[model samples]
Target: MATLVAIGYPDETTATAASLEARRLAKDLIIQPDAIATIIRDREGKFHVTTTHHPVGAGATWGMFWGFLFGLLFFVPFFGMAVGAGMGALMGKMTKGAINKEFQDQVRDLVKPGTSALFLVIERSTPDKAVEAMSQFGGTVLKSSLSKETEAELQEALHGEKSAAEV
Candidate 1:
């Protein structure tokens, strides 16, 4: 199963740096992500999103996923309660596996004004190396579809604890 991981940074620069590191990791085969994106909310509260060109042939799938997610999280409120409800129902019917209400709420909170986030749909990864390499960027894990045990391992790795193999 693919893991959906969202990490929030204090600003767009940090998030962009982290995304580049993630891409490097993917290139080195330390992690395999189906899709990767960076979302930045400007001071004016507008969202700017950029996605990588990896995972060829699945562009349309990821594009729709990101569009719906961003629209639900950022655009719905401006559209008012009625449209929000309609979009909520549509989202529930259209999405599956991990993209539920809680995740959506967490994402909404993560990318506040002047903040940024890195979103990854990962197929697989070397948790230790990936975490170690990324810890320097100092991001908060906004949400993830990983299992409880796996999430714990990731947290430990982020905290510089023993790696998965060591544990």
Candidate 2:
């Protein structure tokens, strides 16, 4: 199973600091993450995304997943209500019981213009150490777990028949 953890910070600096801390922890083996990324929404509402290169070689797969997820959470709203609603229904169905409406809503609410967010796909972790180290940054954290099967389903939903490697 993999856990998706998103932390929203008031500014890009804090979010970047938190992302660095997460990378440090991963390097120390305090947490094993499949991938990590940061999303910053500038004052003009433009989004800048940065993704790390995973040592485990899952970078491309998770990178694509993050892009699609961010597109739904941030970009869809700009397409007008009809399109947003249709996409919302699709997201709800695709996530189903895993990353449900509430989780999606919380994520949407957390990330606003002039703010930033750190996203991590954790495979294993020493929760206490990881949380303690990151808590000092003081961000709003939202998390959800995906079973292996559900992850495959999500990948399929996002990319049709393409496998993760092909992504």
Best by lDDT: 2
lDDT value for model 2: 0.67
- Model 2's TM-score against the true structure: 0.71
Best by TM-score: 2
Candidate 2 residue-wise lDDT at 145: 76
Candidate 2 shows a clash count of: 0
- Each model's C-alpha lDDT? 0.62, 0.67
lDDT of 2 by residue, 85-162 (tens): 323444565545656568779988988989999887665664345666889998888887776666555445433443
Clashing pairs in 2: none
Q: How far is 67's C-alpha from truth in model 1 (Å)?
A: 2.0
Which pairs clash in the backbone of model 1?
A: none
Query: lDDT by residue for model 1 over 1-167, one digit each (tens)?
Result: 34677888888688899988988888887665436778899988888887753322212234445566666667723222122332344345434533556887888888888899887766466444566677889988754455444433332322334334445
